[model samples]
Target: MGALADNRRFWLACNLVTLVLHAFGVYLYASEGFAHPVAQLWAIVLMLHMLEFPLAFIAVRERRIGWGVTIMATLIFGFTWWVPTRRGVFHA
Candidate 1:
């Protein structure tokens, strides 16, 4: 149906935007060499990048709870993993 097509387009657009942001974050991190202050933030962004695929899969399958949990896990992972690395608690 038309509505389904429209929804798909919307999701596609969202995914594109997310990818762009992730790519930009990567550029910033790589070019700057992942120093303090920005490293952790970049790490979180990277983790978010990793979560996109699984989240999209759940979304496309219409699994609401799965999508929610995936999103939450992404956030947790990003903060825990990325933030610490930025603070120099971990390397790579």
Candidate 2:
């Protein structure tokens, strides 16, 4: 039980960090612009965030919706930061 709680806390912390980084990436992209692939990837990630709303609703009604939102949120957060950095969006 203690291990599970710790794992959840770790994941939550990771999620929060990812969210903040993703927000920073969005700001950087808007202000500085990004390459085609980076822009496309960010757009897709934003779309996934939007898509999670409906899934979240479903999850509210069904306990077994499979943590899809949590997973996608984490992925979007990581991918957004990685794609931009890899594409030299922040090369200054």
Candidate 3:
């Protein structure tokens, strides 16, 4: 993804992968027993990854959801919300 645009939707789209990964992680956690070291580690990563939601929210409010955030979110959880970013909803 290019950086010269505020591709909020793209960011959100990318976030969908995170959902799938999280779901699978949850299943593994349950199947392996909640206290399993791998499960615990996945849970911790998920918890920390969740912080991106608020950060994305802030970016939306600022109208600055750049490609960096978008790609990161895409690589991560995908976006959890929509924003009228210049290169996204309001793109010319």
Write the candidate numbers in order of decreasing TM-score: 3, 2, 1
The local lDDT score (0 to 100) that residue 61 gets in candidate 2 is 36
lDDT of 3 by residue, 1-92 (tens): 36523566555564565566667778888788676766676677666656556555565655656656654552354333333342355431
Structure candidate 2, residue pairs in collision:
none
Candidate No. with top TM-score: 3
Residue pairs with backbone atoms closer than 3 Å in model 3 (clashes): 12-79, 14-78, 15-77, 15-78
Which lDDT values do the candidates have, in the order given? 0.49, 0.50, 0.55
**Error at 30, model 2, angstroms:** 2.8
* lDDT (Cα) of model 1: 0.49
Record all residue pairs in model 1 with backbone atoms less than 3 Å apart, i.e. clashing: 40-86
lDDT of model 3, residue 2: 62
lDDT of 2 by residue, 1-92 (tens): 44533454454565576566567667768876775455555667677666555444443333333455445543565433222223333221
Task: Give, for candidate 3, the lowest lDDT window spanning 10 residues.
Answer: 78-87
The clash numbers for all candidates, in the given order, read 1, 0, 4
**CA RMSD (A), model 2:** 12.2
